[model samples]
Every structure is written in C-alpha cells, then in structure tokens.
Target: MKAVGFHEHGPLDNYDLLDVPTPEVGDGEVLVDVKASALNYMDLFAVRELDNYVPQYPFWGGGDVAGVVTECGDDVTAWAEGDRVVAVPFLSCGDCRFCVRGQEMLCEDFTMMGEMRRGGHAEYVAMPEENLIPIPDDADFVTAAAVPVAGGTAWRALVPRAKVQSTEDVLIVGATGGVGTYAVQICKNVLNVDTLYATTSSQEKAEFLRDLGADHVIDYTEERFDEAIWKLTDKQGVDVCYNNVGGDTWVQSMRTLRWGGRLVTSGATVGPNPETEIRQIFMRQLDIVGSSGANSYELAELYDYVWSGDVEPVIDDTFPIEEYMTAFERMDNRGLYGKIVLTQE
Candidate 1:
C-alpha cells in the first residue's frame, strides 16, 4: 500500500510517500479502501510536534477518511465488505468513565487516529468497526472525506459544546478554512443567527465566506476585526465568538464577545501559547468552552446535514493520493479557503 509518513519528527520534508506494508485487520476492526482523505491543520502539526503526538516513528497522520470497507474483522457485525463509510478518527478507551457517558472526547485515554497511529493518508486504512460512520450510499467520497474533522469540529463546537441559540449574534474568527466555513453555515443556515460575522485575510476569502452564509465579512488584513465587529454591533459585542485561530487573536476574540457570551474553540492553529488578557475572560463574566473532535453521535448528525444539503463541505481543491506532499505544502501556506482533499486514483 502507498502511504505518506515520516520515520522521525522534523520538517515537512521528512514526510515521505512510500509503499509500506498494508495494515492488517485485527478482531473488531475493518480495513477500508480509502477512496478519499481530507487534510486538516493537525495533520501538519503532528509533523512538527514531537512531544505529545504519534505513538511511534514512521507515523502517518490523516484524520478524515471516506471510503469503502474491503474486509471486516471476525468480531465485527455492524459493517461488512463494500459498506460505504466515514471514519470517526478520534479514539478513546470505551471502558473509561467518559466513554460510558458518551463523552468520549473527554476520555483521559483519548487519542486521535492519525496522531496515535498510522492514518488514512494512504491507499488503505484499518480502523475499529465502532469508529466508522455510515454515509448515504450516494454520498461522494471527496465531500464525505471533507466532513469528518473539519465539518465535525465546527458542528461539535457550535451545536453541542456551545449550544448556540438561533437568535444569537455570532462572530467566527478565521472563518475561511473548513471549520470556519462550516461554523458560518451552521450559524446561518441551521442556527439562524440574527447576525453572522467572520474574519479572513483577503476580500476574496471574505466574499467566499459571504457565499457560505456569513452576514458580515471582515478582512483582517485591512482592519482589526474586533474593532470592526464592535462598530458593526454599535459598541455592543456579539452574543458568541468562535475562534480556532489562537494567537494574538485570543484577546480580540474575547473582546468581540458580549458580556456573558461564550467563546468556543477547537484549535489554535495560529499558536497555542497565546498572550492573554485574563480580564477579558474573568471580568467580563465570559464563558470559554473548549471542544475537540466530533463524537460518534455528532459525526452522524453532520452526515445527515451533508446528506440533506442543509450544509455542505467547502472543498478548496483535490489532489491525487500520490501528491500528499503537495497538498501538505498548500495547507502549510494557509492559502486555502476550505479543505484540500486527497483522492485515490
């Protein structure tokens, strides 16, 4: 099987496309013939972060996969050969307290598929039967692949974690990427927010966000979005602020939220250790909620949204599986307005 992986953690250059041994399907697992895989910021992060990601050397990292089941394990009964599926790539010990309560993302033993082991940036992947979600038979693999991590993150952040109300006004910082675009869609199309605001680096991306249902688009390159949002709201902040770009934007993101409004986040792609203004959180009586991968139930919900056309994955581009390195390079530049998918030829 052809896969992309790194034998050691270092630069993006370390990621090599090679023909490695195909993964074996153990009991309770299924081997998927990966039709498509979506790239996320975490895929690139795992390439550089040496401390707390990946279980071993020669690790491959891709969390979003959509494909057909080619083989099933002896203990697997829920899925079989030729089942069309999308993977819930984050894994947790099912016996844990959190897992039993359906809060698997909070399990102490929680680990991501790509981060913990080899992932779907390959021709084939073997995952536990329980980790797969069934998509509609007609669902295209590229779009389904785009939904798992990016769409799932946005859904988990906005719907379950934040519990955003329909009438609320929203500001989504860095709303051009996969999660951002989905957040915009959910805020507008699903939640029906009174006002939906988003930030991007350029007017082109701002227009793209507008088409995705953002009511107001702020070009961060030309203006400070926090100030712009405050002015737009007439000095009153928004009811909610969703931020995944965590750097200097942390302070501004908090400022854009109304008193007692929530600030939800799933990632800090900008930089994790952000300079803080604790006062914005405490003095303002703001609620800061953190979210991670989509739980199985949430992924299922996202599939329904995509299947029903209530929301759609924003696919920026597609590349052949052999061009994984090229896709990673494009992602590293942060030039895309949505996800870049890798498809099997």
Candidate 2:
C-alpha cells in the first residue's frame, strides 16, 4: 500500500510516500479504504517535533479520516464491508475509570490517531469497529473527514469546556484554522449564542467568520484583539473566550474575558508557555479550564450536526495524498480558513 508517511521524519520536507505493507484487520477492527483525510496543526508537530513518537518506520500521520470498510473482523456485527465510516481519532483504554464513565478523553491511556499510532493518511487503514461511525451514502467523504476532529474538538472547547451560555457573548481567538471555523459555527448554529466575536489575522478570514455567523470579526493584525474586544464590549468583556492559540495570545485571551467569564483551551498552536499576570484570574474571578480530545458524547452530537448540514465543514482545498506537503504548507503558513483535505485516490 502507498501511504503518505515517512521512514523517518525531520520536517515536512522529509515526509513523503512510503511503500508499506497493508495493515491487517484484528478482532473487532475493520480495514478501511481511506477516501479522504483532513490536515491539522498537529500534523506539523508530528513530522517535526514529535521525535520517536511512532513505534516503527513508514508511519502515516492523520487523525481526521473518512472512508469505506473493505473488510471487517469476524466478530464485528455493528459494521460490515462497504460501510461508509468516519474515524473518531482518539483511542482510549476502555477499562479506565474515565472511560467507564464515558469520559474517554480523560482516560489515563488516551492517544490520538496519527500522533501516537498509525493514522489514515494512506490508501488503507485499519480502525477498531467501535471507533468508526457510519456516514450516510450521500455525505461527501472530504466533508465527513473534515468533521470528526475539528467539529468534535470545537464542540468540546465551547460546549463542555467553556460551558458557553446561549445568552452570553463569546470570542474565539484564532478563528481561521480548522477548529476555529467549526467553533464559530457550533457557537451559532448549535449553541444559539447571542453574539459571537472571533479574531483572525487576515481580513479575508475575518469576513469569512462574519459570513459564518460571527457577529463581529476582529482583525488582530491591525490591532490587538484584547483592545478590540474591550472596545467592542465597551470594557465589559465577553462571557466566554475559546482560546487554543496559547502563549502568544494567552494573556490577551484572558484579558478579553468578562469578570467571571470562562476561558476554555485545548491546544497551544503558538508557543505553549507565555507569561501572564496572575492577578487577572483572581481579581476577575475567571475560570481557566483546559480540555483535551473529544469523547464519544461530543463526537456523536457533532456528527449528527454534520449529517444534518446544520454545521458544515469549511473545505478550503483538497489535494491528493501524494501532495500532502502542499496541503500542509497551506495549513502551517496560516493560508487557509478551513480544512484542507487529502484525497487517498
């Protein structure tokens, strides 16, 4: 099988196709013919910073995948061959206390596909039956692939982590990436947020955010987002701030929140550690909450929205598996407003 992986990774320039043996189907697992996969910032880290993360050579890294089952394990009854499915990215040890309670994201042994294990950036990838969810026949593979990671993650950030209220005004710092696009949509379409403010460096993305239901879009390149938010809210600050950009924007994100507002975070795409005034948290009574991978509950609800078209995937571009470097280049340089999908064919 030809996969978009590398024997060894030093940088994105070093990653290319690898002639790897096909993965075998295990009990309760299914072999999927990958149709489409989506790119994320983590892909940049996987190929560059995550040294020795894979157990072997020829590792293909991808977390968001949509495909069709070509073969199913003998014990698998819930799914069969030719079933259209989307991979739920995260794998958890089912016996853990968190997993038993359905909070698998908190599992002690939680790992993400393509980051800690073999991912679906290949022609064929094997997934556990439980981690695969059926998609309707009419659902586009590229769009479905874009949904699993971004949609569920954005839902986790806004819905559960931030506990966003429908009547509260919210802000999404860095609203142009894969998760940010979905976060804006989920805030409006799913959560019915009263008002939405999102930050982006480009005016193109700022307009995109507005069209996607953000009440206000802040172009942070021209002015600081914290100042913009302060002015926009008349110094009242927003009720919630969905901040994944970390370090560079952490203090500003905290400053944009209202007194008693919540700041929910998942990733620090920018530098992870940044200095901040500790007084802000104590003085304003802010809630700084951190969340990780999306569990089954969030994934299921997010997929339902995807199936219904209430929350749609924002596909900026699609590249063949062979051209993943180009797709990733667009993501790494912040040249995309939404997911850039990779076609396995």
Candidate 3:
C-alpha cells in the first residue's frame, strides 16, 4: 500500500509518500478499501506532534474515511464484504460508563482514529467493526468522507451540546473552515436560527459563507467581529455563539453573546490560552461549554441529514494520494472554503 506518513514528527516537509505494508484485519475488525479520505486541522498538529501528542513512529493521520468493506475479521457479524461505509473518527471502549450512556465521546479511554494508529491516508485500513457506519447508498465517497469529523463535530457543538433554539440568534466564528461551513448550514437550514452571522478573513470567503446560509458576514481582517455583531443586532448581541477558534477570539465570542447566551467550542486551532473576561461573564450570566466529537447516535443523525440533502458537505478541492502535499499546503494556508478530500487512486 502506498501511504502518506512521517517517520518522526517534526514538520510538514517530513511527510513522505511511502510503500508500506497493508494493515490486516484483526478479531472484531474490518478491512476497508479506502476510496476517499478527508483532512482536518488535527492532521497538521499530529504531523508536528504538538502538545506532546506523539504517534507511533512512521505515523499516518487522516480522520474522515469513506470506503468499502473488503474483508471482515473473526466475530465481525455486523458488516461484511462489499458494504459501503464511513468510519467514525472517535473510538471508544464499548464497556465504558460514557459509552454505555451513549456519550462515547466522553469515554474515559477514548481516542481518535489516525491519531494513535494507522489511518485512512493509505490504500487500505483495518478498523474495529464498531467504528464503521453504513452510509446511504446514494452517498458518494467524497461527501461521506467529509462528514465524520467536520460535520459530526459541528453537529455536536451546535445541536446537542449548545441546544440552540430556532428563535435564537447565532454567530459562527471561522465560518468558512471545514467545521464552520457545516455549522452555518445546520444553524440556517436545520436549527433555523432567527439570524445567522459568520466571520471570515476575506471578502471572497465572506461571500462563500453567505451562500452557505449566513444572514450576515463580517470580515474579521477588517474589523472586530464582536463589535460587528453588536452593531448588527442593535446592541442586543446574539443568543448563541459557536466558537471553535480559541485565543483572542474566545473573549470576542463571549462578548458577542447576549445575556444568558451560550458559547460552545470544539476545536482550538488558534492558540488555546485566552485572557478571559470574568466580569463580563458573570454580569451577563454567560455559559461556556466545551465539546469534542460526536457519538454514534449523533453521527447517525448527521448522516441522515446529509442523505436527505438537508445538509451538504462543501468540497474545496480533491487530490489523489500522490498530490497529498498540495492538499496539506492548501489547508495550512487557510485558502479553502470547505473540506479538502484525498482519493486513494
């Protein structure tokens, strides 16, 4: 199998396209012939080994996978050969307390695929049967590959974790990124927010966000988005803020919310430590909630929405395995409006 990986974590230049041994299915596992895979910002962190997250030597990381089952291991009765599926990124011990309660993302022994072991960046991958979800027959590999992490995370943050109401006003920070695009769609089309606002870097990106259902777009590069939101809402502020970017944006996102409003976060690509405004938080009775990946039930809901066309994955570009470097570069530069997919041709 031709795999894209790094021998030791260092930098993007360390990644190489190597001919590696194909993974074999184990007991209760399934061997998937990877048709398409999608990249996330975590892939960049995994490659650099940030925050002491060390992968096994010769590591490959790709979170979202859409493929076909080529073989099933012993005791894997739920799936068989020739089944089309999407692999859930988070893997949990099914016996854990959180998993038993259907909160698998909070399991004590939870870990994500592509972070701890070989991932779908290769031609084939062997994952536990429990990690596979049968996608709709009409779903294409590229679209299915885009949902597991990006769409699932957004769904978890906005729908279940935040419990956003249709009458509420919402703001999506970094609204043109992978998770942000889905956040906009869910807020506008599914959750049906009263008003949807999003922040991006450029006018072009702002326009892209508008098309994704943002009622208002603010170019953060030009002005402070919190002030923009305040002005737009006539100083009432939004009822909910979906904030994934951390650092300075954390304080800003909180400031954009109205009294009793909630802020939910999943990713922290833009530096985690932020000088929080405790005075404003207490005075306004704000709620700050941290979320991670979605559980099996949440992923099922997201898949159904996608299959019904109520939600769609935005693809910025697609590349073959050989051009993986270009795909990484595009994501690293923040030049894309949606997910970047890689095919295993």
TM-score, cand. 2 vs. native: 0.97
Residue 325 Cα positional deviation in candidate 2, in Å, after optimal superposition: 2.0
Candidate 3 per-residue lDDT over residues 1-345, each given as its tens digit: 888888877789988998889997899999999999999998898888543555466778888998999999999999989999999888899888887888888889888887866688989989899888997787799999999999999999998899999999999999988999999999988999999999999999988888879999999999999999989999999999998888889889999999999988898888878888998789999998889888777998988889999999999999998999999999999888889999975
Q: Candidate 1 at residue 187, lDDT?
A: 86
Candidate 1 stretches greater than 4 Å from native? none
Error of 2 at 44 (Å): 1.2
RMSD of each: 1.1, 1.2, 1.2
The whole-model lDDT of each prediction reads 0.89, 0.87, 0.89
Q: Residue by residue across 117-192, what tens digits does model 2's lDDT show?
A: 9898888888888898888988889988998777788888788778888899999988888889899999999999
**Please, what are the lDDT tens digits per residue for candidate 1 over residues 103-123?**
999998987878777799998
Ranking by lDDT: 3, 1, 2
lDDT of 2: 0.87
Model 1 / residue 248 / CA error / Å: 0.6
Residue-level error in angstroms, candidate 3, position 101: 2.0
